[model samples]
Every structure is written in C-alpha cells, then in structure tokens.
Target: MDDDDDYWNTSETKAKAFNFDDDVLSTQEILAIGQKSYSPSGPSEESLFNNISITTVQSAAIPLSSLVSSKVLDLILLAQSGKDPSKETKYEPEQTVAMTLKRLTLGRSCSLHVHRSMKSKTELLDGALAIGDGNAVLTVVLFLIQTLNKKLVYELLSSRPVALNHYIAFLQNEGKISELADLLTMLGRSPEAAMYQYQHTVKTQGNNVDVLLRKLTNLLANHFNQPGVDQHQAKMISDYIKLLEWQKHVNKPDLKYNSVIQWLAYNCTHHWHEGAGNAMSPLTLCQRHQITPLQYDWVVLNVHAKSGKWDIVESLFTKKDWFGRTTISSNIPIETLLSRLSQLQASKQLLATCVNKVANSDDRLRLAHMYKIHAVVIETLAKQKDRSALTNYKMTLNPQSEEYILAENTLRDNSIKWKN
Candidate 1:
C-alpha cells in the first residue's frame, strides 16, 4: 500500500518512470476509481427546512381566507394611519367618479388621478357636459390645461371641440371676454380673437365714449395689425372709428354749425375751416383719415340733416364761385339728396332748396314735378315758354289754388311767345 501511494503521487520522478503501455489500469481498477469518485446526491428537504422558524411555518399553514383578510386589515390600517395621504381611500370606480364630480360642482380643481387616467378624464368631461354644468366642464379643462403641455392641450381641445366650445361659452356667459380672447389666441385663431374683442367692446359700450374710442383705436392699431388679419376688414374698422369720432365731434355744443354760425360770419368760410389746426371738421377728419368726400357729404346730408342742423347741412354744400356768390357745390347728385331728404320727411321748402341748386333746367323740372315743387315747375316752364307744359301743370292742381291760377294766367297770356 505504501508503494502504491508513492507510485500514484504526482512527482516529476514518478511521472518519468510511468510507461503508458505497461502501466495501463485494468477494467476493475478503472471501475474502482470511478466508484470512489462518485459523490452523494443533494441534501434532503428536511435539512433545508429545518432552520426555518416554526412561526414562519405556522403562518404559511394559515387558511387562504385568513391570508386575504390580513391583507385587507393591513390596507385598512394603512389608510387609517394616513401613512400615504395621496393614496385614495375609495377603490370602487363608481365611488371615485362620484367623489371627483362632487368636487368639480363645488368649483374645486380636478383630482390629480384624472390627470394620469385618460378614461377617467373622458368620463368626467362627459358627466359635466351631460348635466350642462359649464363650471364643471371648465374646471376639468382648466386642470388639463395646467397639467398638460401646450401641444397635448392643443391636441385635446382640437380633438374634443365640444369642450372648447363649452369653455368659450362659459367665459362669454361670465362676461370674461378677455379670457375668451386669450383662449382663441392659444388655439391659433388670432383673427377671431381680435374680432371677438372688437365685437364685445362695441356691444357693451360700458365704458365712457373716450374710453371706448381708445379701446377701438388700440384694437385697430395693435391687434388688427398682425399678419393674419384681413386688411380690408381693418380698413372698415378704421373707417367706422373715423365715423364715430366725427359723430362725437359734431355733436359737441361748441362745434355744432348753429353754435359756430356767428364765428363763420366774421371768419372766412374756408372748406373744413382749413386754417384751424387740430380741427375736427368732417372734411378735415375725412381727408386726414383718407375717408372719401362722398362719404363725408352723405353723412352730413343724411345724419346732420336729420338732427335738424340745416346750417351745418348748408355749410357742407356751400362753396364760393369766382363772382363771390355762394353756390351749393354738392358732391352727391341733387336728385339723390332730394330722394333721401324726402324719405327723411324733410319739409317741401328744404326739398325745393335742394332742387334750386340743380344747374340743368330739365333735371330741375323733372325733380320739381316729382317732389311737387310747383313753384320751380312754373318758373322753369315759363322760362322755357312751354305753354303746353304750363297747361298740363294747371290741370294737376286745384283751380282755386294760387299755383294753379298762376299757371292759368301764364298760359292765357299771348304777350309772351308760347312754344308749340
């Protein structure tokens, strides 16, 4: 055995002496080495579980119902302890919805959980819309607007257009027009936003006239000056502002033509009182603002005339000729003035005054007959020596009337040459 141990020892001397052909082990020897090398299987389950505490074993042996009940108790105790205040107490879906909606009705901010759960938000919005509770809808939308990024919020509003409309209606109903404008601007509808502000300002007119005018001017200069706004619409707004300013200036007691008639008596009657710096005359303001002369004349004739300012009306048409005579240099046709004045129920004297301004006899006669200005008709007919026209004019009037009698005398006179 000692010799065999020395032979098996892995030394360089023993290794060199070993010959592979002569020292080859027999089958029984190889079998004996394999059997010695074989080891026991893994440890038994008893050894593995032996160190586990008896308490742990007993807990694992507990019934499934008891295990579940313990979990419930743990949850209940955790909730009562308020260890996690953010964790919701209610677990049922219906209860969660009721609690959220109740908060919204009281004008409270939406719960944070809805910010995470898309379905929850949709259901909440639907509930608000179903009941027509605008405040509630606004609450949810505002919450989304605050929590979400601009791109997401825009997508949300774009996809759910009803929510946007409800929000707009809520703002409008609350008279929060500025907020409404902001909402429109956020949605990339700036033109609508500008117009919205303009319409509201005009509609309310709650401010003083000067204050209102300033607001409109600000809108025209700043808001409507953007690239997307329509130039034509801005021009229209500018004209309206001009007209409003003109109307206000004209209504001033010191500026009214009747009030200023004495001033004109001594001072030369320059068009728009030309030399008066900072004058608010119709012609001055209109020309300065590029408003057309026709528009200025129309407003003066129609609006000022209705207000019974005949001096102002006459001053607009009154112009100086080379002979220093006052002539009615009306930019509008005399016929149009007559028709408009007639609709305004102007007196026949006023109508005849407009008629006598016509330079053409034919136009004057036709307008005079149409407007029943018999004096103009008789005068014009006599000047033309139209006995047939005079006779025809006589039959239309009462024989006892003065105008009819004059026509009869003119026709009977043979001293004047009567045209056939």
Candidate 2:
C-alpha cells in the first residue's frame, strides 16, 4: 500500500508538471496571453490601419448606407485602402503585395466599373464629386453620357460646372474632339463648338488647302451662320464664312469672274442680309477685301449687263444728290463706261445718253461719229458752230437721213461759225 501511494503521487506530480491549465486561469489572464502573442508589433502597424481607414473615409470611396452599386466604390476603396469588402478575413502576403501595387497605380490598375445601378446620374456625379477626384468625376460624366444620352448629360452638367469643366479637360486630353464639340453644342455654345472645329481643321488639314477650305466652308454654312448666336459673334462668323467661301470659289481650277459676280449678287440680294443678322453684304465684302470702287463697278456693270438687267446696270453709274438731281457718279470715266457698254451690245439710246455726257465737244463729236450716234453727232456739230466740220460730217451721213438734213439746216443757218 505504501509503494502504491508513492507511485500515484509521482504520476500526479508528472501530470502537474506537463499540464498547461494546472492553475485555473481567469478570462482576463487568458485574454492577456492571447493578445501578447497575436498583437501587432508597434504603432506603425496601427498607423497603417488608421491611414487606410482615413483614406477610405476621405475618398468617400464606398457608400455604406446608399443603395447604389458598391462595386466601383469597393474597388476604389480596395485599391486605396488595401481592404477588400468581399473578404473580411486577413490577407495573404501575396494579396497584400498586389493590393499595395494597385494602390500605387490607382487609375491604371482598375479602369472605372460603370455597371448599371439604381443611382441616378446626379447621384453618381455627387458621389464622384464627394471623392474629389477629377478622373472620377470625368468617369461619371462619361457614364452619364452612355446611359442617359448626351442630351440629359448636358442638362446634368449644366448644373454642375465644376464636373463639366473636369470632363472637358478629360475630353481635350484624350483627343475626343467630336464628342467635345457635341457637348458644346448641347450646352447652347454652338458657336464655340464651331470655332473649335475650325481650329481643329486648321491644325490638321492646313497643309492641304483645298481640303481645309472645304471643311471650313461647310462649318460656316452649317454652324457658324446660326441666328441664335450673339450678334457680334455672328458677324465675325459671317465674315469668316464669306472669306472661306470666297477662297473656295477663287481657288477653283476654272474660275470665272462672271460666276463670282453672280454668286456675290445672289448672296447679297437674298441670303447675306435679309434674315441673316449681321451678315456682310456684297458691297461690304468687297470693301473688306480691299477691292477698289472702280473694279467693283466694272464687275457689277458686266454682271448686270449679262443678266439683261440693263436698267440696274444704268442705275449703278448714277447717284442722286440731296436735291434729288440724278447725275453720273463719275467714279468711272464716261468713255470707259461707253466702251464697255458698247462691247456688251448696249442699246443705241444708251450709247447716245453716254455720248451726251461728254464735256469736250471735239472729243464728243469724234466719239459720237465713231459710235454712229447720229443725233448726238448733229447736236454736237450744231453746238460747235463749225459749218466746215459739219459739212465734212454730213459727207459721212446719207443725204436722205434726218441727221444729214439737220446738219445741212444747221450749216445754212450761218449763225454756226465756220472754224476755217
């Protein structure tokens, strides 16, 4: 019985020596031990955790309460905060490294996830703005364009100037010229959009003059001529359009001045000024391009004459004074007018009218005789009172003609002096 008790005591001693729970530890003691073993090493680990939490908070990268999609938010938060919402557990070392890399390259690592969600565009924009990321704001704008159409996107952006500006910058940087122009148009900034297209064309197609002119002309005809634009801007656009159109017409391989004249007349008479507010008239265009008055008159004369608008052609050379006395404008010489008119197959009555305006009788008689303006020839001979010259003029006329008879009657009246 002594040996049995000694063996049992030895076994109990051995068990006590090996047993981990020999001392009935309290909960606190157990917890303290566990913490000492599993706790992070220092404040650095705590600081990292706190920084991630702050980044997630400040970035507004997640909507914890909102019913909107959290995928984009979760990815952004995961990229920035190094925490995955899908997995609440601890990260493996490889995953931690990967997430760190993703954080380092934010936009490149994850493109925007623009999945359809319950959020309205305004709500999405607000959320993006809350993050204060320009790229994020632009991404939301693009998503808005895709989902709600550009029309609604414009309305939404109209209220959000900052976001609109950010998206503009993004489009410019990305070379999205057409989309940018469309946005500008939808915002009631069509003139600015037209100018943007003009600039773009000038930059890209400038080396090819024909192509450049074609594109610029089309833009002006279509967009720059909009009446809803500001008056001053419209005038500027009008002038530019005219310039481009003129260039296009003038640069043609087979250019005709008559065609140009007709084009100018048609535009000025109808399209240029009637309802086109601030558009330059043909005369205004001529002046702007430094065409001289005489050159313009010549062009006008020939153009009207060819069109059988003889009265308009005649009216162009005359001006009415304040007293309502109609006289030749005298901007062009009478002789030059007569010569051109004659070439245009002017009426004999027109020729006589021109001959009658000559102040020099000798020159008048000579021109009158040359043009066969018989009435002017006889009148000029009677005014000169040179019977010998009148007789010589009579030799050129048929004796039976009235002009010849008038010359003979003038000679017989001897009040006409013989400049013998």
Candidate 3:
C-alpha cells in the first residue's frame, strides 16, 4: 500500500508538469493571443475597430491597450481629481486630441465618452472635421446642429468647405434636393441653388411644359445672367431651351414637319445674313436630322414647284458662280436632278437644260443611257469611238449585219490617231 501511494503521487506531479509546459506560449502564440484580445469582432465592423487594433498594432507592433489600460485608468482618475495628465507627463494637447479622436472612431459607445471628454466645442469640431470621414463628420454635424447653436454650427461647417461640399453631395444623393438648395443658398451660391431648384421642379412638374418653360426662362434671366456666371453654363442653358423648343414642336402633328422646315430655313438664312460662315447650313442641319439628301431636295423642289416658283427650281439646276459655290436651293447634283426630272416627261425640257451643264463625258453618257436620249447618246459615243462605245453603238443598230460592220469600221477609223 505505501509503494502504491508514492507511485500515485509521482504520476500526479508529472501530469501537472506536462500541463504547465503546454501553457507556456511560444513567440508566435504570444503575438496571436495579443491580436485576438485586441482584435475587432468581424471584418464588416473593421472600420469601427480599425484605429483600436490594426492601426495600433502597425504603429506600436504590439497591443499597448493590454499593457497600459490600468495605468490609463489611473491617470484618468487622477486627472479628474484636479491633476492634469499633460502636467504630470509628456502628453501634448495635440497628441491627446488625436488619441481621443482615434478612440472615438471605434464606435458610438466610444464616441459618446470621448465627445464628453473633449475640452471644448472647438476641439470636437476640429477632431471630427480632421477625421474627414463623410459619414462620421455628418454625424458630428448633426449632433452639433441638434445640441449647439445654429450660428455656431453654420460657422463650423463654413470653416470646412470641403466637408460642406461632401455633406451637400450626400444630401443630394439622398434626394434631399430642397435642403441642398437651401444650404447652397445660405453659402451664397445662388446659381447652384437655383440649378438644384430647377432640377427638382423639372422632376416633379415635368408634364407641365409651359410652366416649366416659364420657370426656366425666369431662372435664366435672373440667376444665370449674373456677372460671375460661367459662360459654359449659360451656353448649356441656351442649348436646353433649344432642345425644349424642338421637343415641343415635334410632339404636335400639325407643327412637326413645317416647324422643322421653318427652323432649318431660319437658321440657314440667319447664318447667311450674319456671315457666321458655313459652320451651320441647311445641308448640315438636314444631315444632323437624318434627312436624306434626296428627300431634302424633293421637299425643296415640290414646295417651289407647287408655289409656281420656277425661278427657284431653275436656280436649283443653274450654276451660280465661278467658285462653284451655290445656295442651298442650288445644291443638288445636276445628274440627280436630271434623273428625277426624266421621270416626268413633261419636265423633259428641264432635263435637257440640266444635261447641257454637264462637264464630264462619263456623266453625260450615263445620263443619256438613263434617259434614252438618242441624240446625246449617239453624239457621246461618236466622240469617244472606243471599243466599248463602238460595241455599245453597234448593239443599238438594226440587226442588219452589213450596217453593224459599217458602224464598227467607222468607229475604228475615227479612233485612229494620224501623225502630224
């Protein structure tokens, strides 16, 4: 029995020794344990706990909170009892404020305590603004607006224009356009405020076209015309007005086609009279509006022809100047006009007149083939006397073999070049 008891005691001692060795942490285990103790709850909550854990670890390479919590508590207690922490230590005011702000960023719980611990309103404002987190600064601003004087809150926000702009953007994103406009107006940005107001009005009263137009006109005359207004902004407003006018006219059945035509005519005439040059012309507008050149020419021709304005139609085919520059009325190619005129045999005289102006041999040949004008066709073929033209003319002759060979020989003889 005595031997058994001694053996049992030895085994128990060995077991305790083994457990103690297991509990002794290695260097890596020590680091992991330290991190676990100070680490935040989860990744989603990282922002709230970043300054406390990861940032602290990166700066100090260790968890200072584990080593210094008790001492910090004692210092706080002493400081509350009329002892200054800075006076008894090397802590500077800037360092203290920075540390406090970092702690406050941990969460609402830390924020409440740190906010109360701040020495003054100025320190709180400076700390919050200095952090530069949009949501955090917004919370601080709301707190100030609620608990502090309005004038003081305004002063604080005004001092940080970048933060103010961010807050304004946040409000706008939240669909609080009215509040954004009011805030902009308070900041003496009347033009921006008016723009926001106009946007809001447009979104709400979009169906009320006349009212919206009047409101826009008023805004342009009152706010946009100011001396300090941006030139580009003014131009944008003008373009919007033009777009609105176009949309308004296009929506009406009676006004749709005529309005566009009239607008094109007015712009072309205006550009010509003002010598704005060729930057904007009827052809350009037609192209921009996706109107085909044929369709455009047809409109001009039909309108003038119906109005008994043959002079305009004639000018459309007439050569205007030595430079070959012509008015919009005279812009159609002669070949195209002749092809169109050939479709109406009553317009044969007009077709002949246009063909007389043709300067290119291939173009005259093509027109003659297209219109079956025998005189022009024979004349053009005789002038060229090439194999292709001779073959073409031979095909046109009666199926008399003798006549065909005679015509071919005549063409070949004409094509022969004699030595001078």
lDDT of each: 0.69, 0.66, 0.60
Deviation of model 2 at 229, angstroms = 36
For lDDT, candidate 1 versus 2, the one ahead is 1
Q: Which candidate tops TM-score?
A: 1
Over 4 Å off in model 2, which ranges? Answer: 1-242, 245-262, 265-280, 319-327
Candidate 3 lDDT score at position 413: 74
Candidate 2 deviates by what RMSD?
20.8
Give RMSD (Å) of candidate 1 vs. truth: 19.3
Compute each candidate's TM-score over C-alphas: 0.46, 0.37, 0.36
lDDT of 1 by residue, 185-216 (tens): 87888888888888888878734567778899
Candidate 2 per-residue lDDT, tens place, 58-160, comes to 4332343353235433444444454444465655443232342244236654323333553444665776676677766776677677777667778888888
Decide which is better by TM-score, 2 or 3. 2
Off by over 4 Å in 1: 1-116, 123-136, 159-162, 169-182, 194-224, 232-283, 302-336, 339-350, 353-371, 374-396, 406-420
Model 3 lDDT per residue over 1-420, tens place: 698677757967555332335644333444444444456662444554566766454432445565556654455455445555445665534434466556557654343333443245557657777776666666666666667766656666787886687678777778898677767767778778777766776676667667777877887887678777676786666656654665574464343324446646555444423332243456655654555666666666755665556666666645556676442334567666665566544255466556656778788878866775555555566666455665677788776665566655655574554222
Scored against the true structure, residue 355 in model 1 reaches a CA lDDT of 85
Q: How close is candidate 3 to the true structure, as a TM-score?
A: 0.36
